[model samples]
Target: MKKEVNIILAGSLGIILGIGLFGLRKFLKKKSQDYDDYYADFHRHFVKQAKDDGNDGIEFLAVQ
Candidate 1:
């Protein structure tokens, strides 16, 4: 009976950890992709302005 209870507890813990890890991975991947998009958009929209406007349009950060 004790052994059976231990097995059940271990199995439950494993399943919960697995689910948490899967969710964490998906969230991180999406965040990474979003950052890539944000930087691409910033470069596309701002680089030309910086060049055209000279020092007046220089930017170090972007907000969406």
Candidate 2:
């Protein structure tokens, strides 16, 4: 009986940890994609303005 209980507990813990890790990976991937998009948009806007104003533009840190 004790061994059975231990097996059940271990299985449950493993399943829970697996689910948590999966969720964390998905969240990080989404955040990385969002950051990439933000930077691309920033560069596009920056280049457009520089062209319009006829001045070489300097790159600054991207903001949200």
Q: What TM-score, computed on C-alpha atoms, does each candidate reach?
A: 0.61, 0.62
Q: Backbone collision count in every prediction?
A: 0, 0
Q: Please give the distance, in angstroms, between residue 56's alpha carbon in candidate 1 and its true position after superposition.
A: 28
> With candidate 1 superimposed using the best TM-score fit, by how many Å does residue 31's alpha carbon deviate from the native?
0.6
Candidate 2 residues 24-52, lDDT tens each? 99999999999998887767744634245
lDDT of each: 0.82, 0.83
Q: Number of clashing pairs, model 1?
A: 0
How does residue 63 of candidate 1 score in lDDT? 28
Off by over 4 Å in 1: 42-64
Q: After the best TM-score superposition of candidate 1, give how far the Cα of residue 40 lies from its true spot, in angstroms.
A: 1.7
Worst 10 residues of 1 by lDDT: 55-64
